[model samples]
Target: MTCKRALTAYPELLSRTVAAPSWVMPGTVRDNAIFLSGEVDEVGLCFFETAACLAYGENDLPEHLADLPLGWHVHLPGDLPWCDGGAEAAVPALRLMDKVAFLGAHRAVLHPPVGFADGAARLVAFVRAWEAAGRNPEDLCLENIRGEDLTGLWRTLCDLGCKVCLDMGHVLSYGQYGLLSLPGLSGRTSMLHANAPGPGGRHLSLDTLDGAGCGVGRAMCALLPDDAVVMVEVFDWEGVRRSLPLLETWFAAQR
Candidate 1:
C-alpha cells in the first residue's frame, strides 16, 4: 500500500520535492531534478544559487517564474542564514520554510554546520522553532555529515524521531577516512544523497562527470527499496547531467 502519512513523492523525490521547495517558495520552473549542489566548484550553480533564494526576497519569487511545480525544495546551508548570530538565524529560515510551504515543497533537506557549537542543541533549537511555526518533525530532513565529529549525530537524530537523509558518498568518504560507517542504516532511512567523485579529492562538478562518487552511489541504491529519493548531490550542472544516467541505471536495476 502507498504511504499516505509518509511524504508524497515520485519515488525519485515524493520521488522527492515540493515539500522541500515549497518551504523556500522560489516558484522556479518546478522540475523533477533530484539534485543538490554547492559552490566549491560550479556544476549545479544555478540550482545552488536558486536554492539559495531562501535568503532572497519573496515577492519577486512568486512573480519571477512562470511555472512552479508542486514539489520543489532547496537544501539550505548549515548556518542557513549564514548571516549572523543564532537568534537571527530563525528569521530567514522561517521565511524560507514559509515560502516552501507557500510554493508547495515536500521536504527541506538540511545539514547541521560542519563545525557546530553543539549538534544536539542546534537540532533542538531548530525543531523548536519549526514547532513554534506549527511544522512537524517530519517536515525537516536532516542530512548526515561527511567530516569530523558527526558519526553519532545521525544516531542522535534517529533517537529524536527525526528523519534521516543519508549521503552515500559521504559515508564512503567518511569510511575511507575512518571517520564514519555505512552499517545499521539499511531501513531506517528517509532519503539518499549521491554523486560520483572526480579529481582533487573533491566531489566532481555535477556538470562534468569525473567519476569518483559512483562507488558509494551504486552501493546506496542497492541498499534501498529502488524507489527511494536519491538526490544526485553534485557541484554543478555537468555533474548533474552525467550522473543522471548512472542514477537511472540504479533505479532500473532494482528488484
Candidate 2:
C-alpha cells in the first residue's frame, strides 16, 4: 500500500540567516534552486519578499527557476491577512496566485488570519475574487496556524471547494486538542508541511521526530491520496538531506 507522492523543499533552505554559505544570498530564489539541484522532486517558492516579481504586468517564473525540471508550489506571503481589509488585503495573495498560475504551480499554500471578526465573510469575498479572476479554486490550499480555532475557516474552505495543507509541526504544537484525530480532516488534505517540532517551537528535520511524532506523521501520510504533495519545510540543507530519507523510509514501509 505504498503511496507515491511529490516531495518538495522549502526555498528558505537558501536563507543566509540560517548560516547559508557565503555565496548564497538570502532571499535569492534562483540561487536556492541551483543549490538544491538534483536533490528534490519539487521546490516550494516562498513569496514573502518577492513583490517585485508579482508586480502588475509581470508574469513568468524567475530566471533561476525557469529551466528547472522540478515543479513549483507556492507559499504565499505570511503577512497577508485576507480577512482584514477585504479585497485589498487579499490583492497581494491574489496577485501571487496569478503568478502561481502563470508558473504552473501545483498549489498555493495560504495562512489565513486568526480571530478576525468577519473571517468567514472575508473568505467568501476572497474566493469570489478568485472566481472573478477566472482562477481555479482547487489550486488554493489553506494551512493551519499554531493557535487558532480553524473550524469556521475549514468550513469556509469546504464551501469554496478548496483543499487543506496540513502542517505536521503545527498539528503537533497546537492541534493536541483533537483536530488531527478528527475524521474527514485527513481526507481533505492535499499537502503536508512535513517537519517535526523542535526547540523553541521551530520546525526540525523530519528525521528528528520522536516515536510518537513519527507515528503521527506516518499516520497522516497514510491518509493522503497518492498524488498529494509533501513539502519538507525545513530551513537548512542538513535538515533537508536528513528528512528526505526519513520520508522515503516511511513511504517504503507503507508498501
Candidate 3:
C-alpha cells in the first residue's frame, strides 16, 4: 500500500510523521532521498557507512536537499570508534552533521558501542565531543541495539541529556523489553525505528511481525511523544510498501 493511502486511512498518523529509509533503492543517498521524498513524510538519510558517505562528498549531494518538502534526519554510522574515547569518531560524525546542516535535521540516530570496558564513559565522551562540536546533545538519539538494551548507560544518558531512538526490531528479536521501562523513556524518545528482524541480521517488513510483536510495537509507540518520528527502517522499497499499510493498521487499532 502507498503511504498516502495509509495516511488517508488513519489520519492520526499525521501527528507522528512516518519516514522511509534513504537506502530504499539501490542508489546513492541523494537518489533515494529524492525518490522517497514524494512517498513518505520524511527521509532517513542512512549514513550507516561512514567511509562511503564521506567518500561521496558533500558537494555531490543534491543541491536542493534542504529545499525538499520532505523532512530529513541522519542515521550516524554504526562503526564509530566509540571504544577509544570517541574523539576520533566524533570528527567524522560532526563533519557529516555539518554536511547535512542544510536539511535542518533535528534528530540523528546513533548505535552506542557495546562490550567495551568503559562503555559508559565512552558514551559520555562521545556526547561531550558532540557538544564540543556545538551540536545539541538532545539531537543525538542513542538507539537500542542487539546485545545492548541501553539500560547500562541509563544514568549517563540522563546526565548527558541525550535522547532515545527505540528500535522495535531489536526489541522483538533480542527480547529487549527492558527498554520499555527506562526511566522517563516516554519523554526522552524522539524517534522510533520500526521493523521486524529478518534472517541473517537484516531488517524485514513490519508486516512480518506477529501478534505479540505488534503488541510490543504498540506499547513502544504509545510511549513516544506526539511529534516523534517513526521510520520504517527497511532498506528496500518493497519492504516499505508492505509495512506502511501495516503501520497504518496498527495506528487504527490504537484508536
Candidate 4:
C-alpha cells in the first residue's frame, strides 16, 4: 500500500525533501523522473558512470529535463580522481554539470577517494577548480563511503565551503558514530543518503533496518537540517517504495 500520510502533513518534515534515485525503473532517466514525480519531492539524476552518462546526456538526453516538475540533483561519478588528478579532476565534473545545467540541480553528491595522503589539499584544489568554472562550491556534497568516513576530511570540507551528504548505512556498517558527534558538522550537512547495508554491503530498504540500525538512523535523522534532502538510496523501485513510508515514520518520530 502507498503511504497514507502525505509527507507534507508532518510539520517537522515539511521543510525537508524526500528523494528517490533516477534509475528506480528500467526505463530512461526521464521516464523514472516522471514516474517518481508523484511519489517524491525530488529525483536524483544519477550519473554513476561519468563517461557513459556524459555521452548519453550530450547526445540522447531529452530537451525537456528542465520541464520536469520536480527538484533535481546529481550523484556524480564515484570514480572521480580527487586523489591523483587534483584540480584537473574537476574537468569531468564540470562537463557533467554543464550537461545538466538546464535541470537546475540543487546539489551534487560525490564519493571522495579514500586513503590518499594530503586528501585535504587535493580536495581544496578540486574546489578551486570547480569555483573557477563558475560553479557553487557548496553544491558539491562529499558523501561518506564504506570503509572510510568523512572525519578525515571534515576540516577541509568546512574550509572549502562544501556540504556533507552523510550516508546513514556507512555510519552504521562502518561504526562511524563519532561522525554524528562532530562539532558543527550537522550545520553543514545538506543531504542524507538513507539506507541500510544488506549482505555483501549492498544497500537495503529502510524497512529492513534492525534495532541497532534504526537507532543509528534515528541519530542521523536528529542531525538533519530543516533544508536537507533525504535520499532513499536503495536502487530498485520495490525497495524504494517500501522505504518511503518507513522514512516518513522515521521523520514523524523526530517531532
Q: What is the lDDT of residue 104 in candidate 1?
A: 56
lDDT of 1 by residue, 105-162 (tens): 5456666545565646666666677667776666566676655334556666666556
Candidate 3 RMSD to the real structure: 2.4
State the lDDT at 135 in candidate 1: 69
In model 3, pairs of residues that clash are: none
Of candidate 2, the 10-residue stretch with the lowest lDDT total is: 14-23
lDDT by candidate, in order shown: 0.48, 0.65, 0.83, 0.81
Best by TM-score: 3
Cα lDDT tens digits, model 2, 1-255, are 211122333232221011111112254566676565455556687675446547624222454455665667778777775545556656887777666564566467877666678777777777777677777777778788865545657777887887788888988877643656555776677787888888797778888888988888887777766667777788776776677666766666666
TM-score of each: 0.64, 0.80, 0.93, 0.92
lDDT of 4 by residue, 82-101 (tens): 65666877889888888887
- Model 4: residues with Cα > 4 Å off, grouped in runs: 1-15, 57-60
Q: Please list the Cα RMSD from the true structure of every candidate, rounded to 1 decimal place.
A: 7.8, 6.7, 2.4, 2.9
Clashes of each: 49, 0, 0, 0
lDDT of 3 at 197: 90
Off by over 4 Å in 3: 1-6, 58-60
Pick the winner on lDDT between candidates 3 and 4: 3
For residues 183-247, what per-residue lDDT tens digits would candidate 3 score against the true structure?
A: 79999999999899989889999889888988887788788787889898999998988877766
TM-score of 3: 0.93
| Order of the predicted models by TM-score, top scorer first | 3, 4, 2, 1
